[model samples]
Target chain A: MLMIKTVLHFDSVSFRYPKQEKGPLIYDSMKFTVREGEFVSILGPSGAGKSTLFRLITGLEQPTGGKILLNGEYFSNRLGHVGYMPQQDLLMPWRTIWENAALPLQIKGSKQADMRISVEELLKEFGLGGHEDRYPAELSGGMRQRVSFLRTILTGSQVLLLDEPFSALDAITRLSMQEWLLKQWEKRKKTILFITHDVNEALFLSERIFVLTDPPVSRMEDIPVPLDRPRTLKALDIPEIMVLKDRLIDQLRTKATT
Target chain B: MKKWREHTYSFILLVVVLVLWEAIAFNIKMTFILPSPTDILMKLWELKKVLLLEHLPATLCIILIGLGISIILGVGLAISMNSSKIIEKAFYPLIIFSQMIPTIALAPIFILWFGYSIWSKVLVTVLITFFPITINTYDGLRAGSNDLKELLLTMGAKKKDVFLLVNVPSAMPHFFSGLKVAVTLSVIGAAIGEWLGAQAGLGYFSRRMMTQFDGAGVFAPIIVLSAMGIMLFLLVKWVENKTLMWRKSE
Candidate 1:
């Protein structure tokens, strides 16, 4: 039997605000893992610690207890080890699309010539071929998100954390973006941990859905979707999938009380 | 059309006011007391060569040099404050306190220290004008939340990288706003400094005319100085528009 490689692991991690402001612990001895090239969606309701988990992963907030391992090795500093795509399409207003895409490379001090060539290729691949000269305001919502994603990818990390990346888009645009993201995940083979509140979005995108039920979330109910590869919206219409979706939704709704 | 109409109204108001002043001056019949609009205008025309070529240039020289120094110092101070919380905590209150003491009160001290030279006038300009630049740019630097900086930091960005990418660009709009205020104040600062003590400059020339009871002559330099201030302000505005062109395009 071939053993899957765990690309990221939260080893008994715990976090509470240093101020201890009003609430119980946000997370108590939480643990999770992402396998190489696997896409995982963390499903939860609003005001849950989903984005906070990403922040800990990104080293914006440090864990009070336990180690965050990347590729089975712990680094004291976890920053720049993963690509983080925030919910907002935070394309710099001052930069053209090309310059925005080139930002990560520029920040990392890559050679200007190499940065230009690489940025050009990524721009073309991302379907931003001729629109490089335009500013963020000129682009549609979907296009701006794509540029944002392209910049995240340029961070040159094997792991990517997407925080509600498609929540702001319209329904049609969100579906298309989901499909595009899935395709990109497969092509890039990067380990992805996506955060979303939408149950359908979680089901459509992930091989596994980790349900973050409530605060002081020591454990998440990790449910494997058991779907075949290269999924479609049509795949979700099956009766068994419907049953699972309803069960998950019911679990989500009542979990707050429990 | 509405804006054009408003400007025309202002022009008509000025004409009415000047006519009233002319009528009043004729009634008073005191050339030394309140010169008529026509008399002031005539004196302005006659003194055009001296005012424009000599006094105007001297005043312009002081304003330009003083404003230039203020720009450099203001940017440096703003950046220094932005880079560290400790510096901000220490200097921010001091900067505010410095503004409390009047620039007129400070001008005499500058003259006492630097002794009626260009340096004294420039120092006074800097004192009056640098505060706006420092405070506004500092506020602009602090405008964005830590999210953007953290975003860059997660990309393996060093301190310099973060400053270049986020801090600098974010502060630019605020910097320009401060600059517009500073440019207008710079004219007042320079003139005041020259007023307290100077052989040349519009302020000195105007004061000299007043002592001689040449009311029209005093008013002539006043007009020249107003023109200078308006011109400087417009120039600064044009530069601001050019530099922040991205803001408008968006």
Candidate 2:
């Protein structure tokens, strides 16, 4: 089989926030590569700078050291190659679901006629076709997340960065969202970089997981998921997957104790 | 239905005030000082031909023209101020100073420059009305949460889009709040300006009656002026409700 090339490379990336003792260094000499079409989840505890990592990828924050390359080129805002789904949904309350989903396309100056068709397709695919006119407030948390997700996809970006997109939901809703998200990802096959503190979330969704430590820190481990493709809820009971879970749990527990 | 009930209370209060005024006026027997509401209404009816057709139109024109200019300038200046901290720093203090100076105090100066023409009244109204709009727009622009701003930036929202989509719309409620105050001020400003110097206006008519010791006539013009203000206020409120229908459901 032919090897897939790296789409994103974070080379010795280090970020130090200003105006703090020792500065807020979330990544120190951190290096990683996300292969084309890969779903990589950055998993860490709260304040571990997982969210900041998303900001870095989106160009909201620049790394103090090292470089970020997308598709072997220097990352630039002009690329418009990354779709970001923030934690809060970030839906404009003034706009209906259709309008909100259509916004990115509109901003990109896509034809208004095409926007309707494209948005409609995405909405229907995401199971939100009938609720087009409803405001963000009218939708449930899970539905909002789905709309936000579709919005990201509609940005026409090759890469999607999700920042705890499901953390706001209840457990039952979150599980359903996860299943839905995986299905969508399977269809789109876009490179995804997700940030979450939920170990099971990382385990359930990503093809690879990077466990990051606290401030002034580096990656604790970058482990390729050994689970098979087209995974289901039943796959969680696999002994090997359970062993992997236990190992990650132990890492988190030890880190907490220390 | 609930709002209609709320309106009824104010109506009842108005009726009580009118009844008390007529009773007290009749008991004391002084039509020259505090005319009965009935007497005032009769005078208003007799003068409606001239007052509503001529003086009322003049006052309405000045108020509308002044309000239109102020809203445009105020919202434009507010957007500019929000765009740059330097602009905000330079203009914000001056705007505060203008508010403190009081339009009434400066009405004479306006009369000196524009004479007894409609321009003078319009100028005064604009001065009185613009402040609240500027202050409210500024407040609205500043009200956006940091995360929301950052979210737009990350999503590739241009500076213009951020202002237009996020800032302007977010500031709308505050803008309307200021507009409400400005609408009332527009009438007050025009009336006060006309009171100081004018050939024709409700204020001019009221002053004419007051000097003649026609208390009923003066009260008639005063009531009409008040009704005009209320009418303008309700019109602005109607527009506000229509434009900001999204807010009402919330």
Candidate 3:
């Protein structure tokens, strides 16, 4: 029996925004793959096209050249294959917390009776069970971010594209959210390509980290993290991981200098 | 603390105005030309049933009908402009020109076309009310956040879904703000239309009372018109609050 791998394969993807004469292209021959249930973080500087990577992978922009495939199927042909969570909570202020959580299902034209139980389970899983009736404004930033995550998960897409999902939260909240997200990712086991600027966060959550420079953006280094599951702050204190971090940091610094 | 102070200060200012009006009236007996707070209150109490219960409903019907038409046309035009740059380019000039054409001047045209009927009043209300709604909705729709839109596009939301869900809801605050202006405009528009030509309304009643030189009578209906305007304004505000409570919580 051949074991099938649900993977996102990017080959030579290139793109630029409208009306730009010459600048670092957001993507230039970018290529990578996220296997089933793998968490891959793309770490780069502010203008490094990390955000654009999410855009390209999620079909927001058509790459000037390249092919993108998810589970051996072309991205162009698929419908509703990937779920995207933006930096902002993006919860509709008019909707109740429950309604906001249920928005993906609502948009997909799912039936109320069916979505209720699934949404209930998801809210409980994300520790937002009782917040069903409350509006998005009533929730704290951390809580709203958690709800946004749940909304992404509820979409039932195999591939999840998250753009700076925890960038808005405070340090303490972001720490906790990273742990929570890791645990959820473990259970749900979807292929995730998360974009973030934080080196520590990329190291903490990603199975593999792709460090990127500012556009003319190519992968600086694709470092595999050998840390154990449910990685703790203590694990990050390991000598080899520290050395790898220093190396990654130095590469980013050299890119910045050039 | 800052929010609380704002609320408290506004409340105090309202009480001060009412107190001053009542106090000066007591000091020097004033006529109905500038009715005192007390006199207005007394008149309101006596005629509440007749004004609020009867004539107020008539005025309200014109306002609601006019306001509804404005929203539909404004939102419809906004959607059209959003979809086609050419349509926006074509109508942008016309919308500005229409705004320049004074609503007061157009009231008589409405009367001439629709006659001295409720239709004329409604037409006038629509003319006054439509512009704000259109401008606000257009700006709101056009000024939608790129990040949110990109996110939706990636999520495989179709164009219609983006418009109905993201664009429309995002523009809602702007739309309601426009509605707030239109709410006041509708009342004024209806009255102004009636001012030009009408069978029965507060405007017609005010004219009749003015002809008789019954200052109190004229004052009475004017007060009622103001009260009606306030009611409609508050009603729109209440709806705004209910719909946009999330903004406050945010």
Candidate 4:
């Protein structure tokens, strides 16, 4: 088997909020690597700087020290280098499903005709084929998340950062959304960095889990799942998977106590 | 059906008030001091040619023209304030202070400057109408999601794109609400401007009728003005409903 290329690399990154110069650092000499075509979940409790990591990668915030490499190259400005799906769907109430999905293309100044084709194809693949004309208010929560995910994919970036995309959905919907997301990831073969607090969700979806135990986070524990491909929800009950789930919860509990 | 019920209730209340006024006026036999509803109606019919054809049109023109200008000015100011903190700080207090300066006081200055020309009336209408639009649009611009703005930024969006896609669309509901308020105030502005000085307008017509002790004549123009105000208000509401159908569903 051939070795996979490293699509993203963080070289001893350090960061603290600019305004809070004297405040505690959020990240200190943090280093990690995500290989190509990986579905890696960043699992941490709230306030563990899970979002700060994504923000740094997206270039919304800068790291005071360290190098961030995308595709084995460092760029000071990382905006547009990666796809990001925020916590809220953040759909424009005025825009219809197709229009919302076409936003990244519009920003890139794609022709209207070109936008029509790309958005149409993606809408169908995302199971939103006939709902393109509907406003955000008309769609259910799960459907809205799909539209948002379509928009994220249209950014045309190799790496995607999803910040708890289904935290607000009902349990039933969230489970389906996870399975659907995993299918999309496999089909597209893009590197995905999913942020979630749910240990079981991390186990169910990602090939590997990066547990952010605490911040100022110096390191993340990289652990591989022992599960096979094309996972069913029933696979969650496997003895090894259950042990990993318990271990993740234990890490989160330790953070909570501190 | 519920709306029809509301209209019937309003109609009955109006008829009851008018019948009571007619009974009192009939007993006193004084058309000047207290004109009956029928007397006012007859006077309105007699003056229809003048009010509808000339003075009514004049006032409506001032309102519509002033309203159009005010909308352009208001949206411009709101956008400027949103784009720059300095502009917002400088103009915000000035706008509030300007409102404190009553139209009764400002009307004289405009009349002195523009004389009896339509400009003076339009100026007054702009003064009255633009406030709501400016304040509401400013608030609406700020009300858009920061997350949305950031999302766009991460997608390589320019400031212009963020403004057009997120800020402008999000501000629509507030802008429409402000417009409804502005349109209603516009009628009042035109009347005040005309009251101070004008060649032809409903306010001028009413004043002239009052001096001649034609009570029903004064009442006639007042009714026309009130009806004009209602029509303009309803027109704004209809446009708002059409533009923001999404708002109605949520």
Q: Model 3 Cα displacement at B249 (Å)?
A: 2.3
Highest DockQ model number:
4
| Model 2 residue A192 CA deviation in Å | 1.4
Name the candidate that leads on TM-score: 4
TM-score: model 1 vs. ground truth: 0.94
Tell me the tens digit of each residue's lDDT in model 2 across B1-250: 8989879989999899889988999998889898898898899999999999999999999998998999899999998899899999999999999878867887899889989889999999999899999999989998876776776676688878778778888898899999999988888888898999999999889988888999999888888898988988888789888877666435
DockQ (Cα-based) per candidate?
0.65, 0.48, 0.56, 0.75
Each prediction's TM-score versus the true structure: 0.94, 0.95, 0.87, 0.97
Candidate whose lDDT is highest: 4
Candidate numbers, best lDDT first, in rank order: 4, 1, 2, 3
* Clash statistics: count for each candidate: 0, 0, 0, 0
Off by over 4 Å in 3: A1-6, A21-26, A77-79, A217-220, B1-58
DockQ of 4: 0.75
- Among incorrect, acceptable, medium and high, the docking class of model 1 is medium
Residues B124-168, candidate 3, lDDT per residue (tens digit)? 888889999999999989777777666666666788887887888
Q: Which has the higher lDDT value, candidate number 1 or candidate number 4? A: 4
What clash pairs does model 2 have?
none
Candidate 4: regions farther than 4 A off: A1-3
Candidate 3 clash pair list: none
- Candidate 1 stretches with Cα past 4 Å from truth are A1-3, A21-23, A256-258, B1-6
List, residue by residue over A102-175, the lDDT tens digit for candidate 4. 99999999998999888998899888999887899999999999999989999999999999999999999999
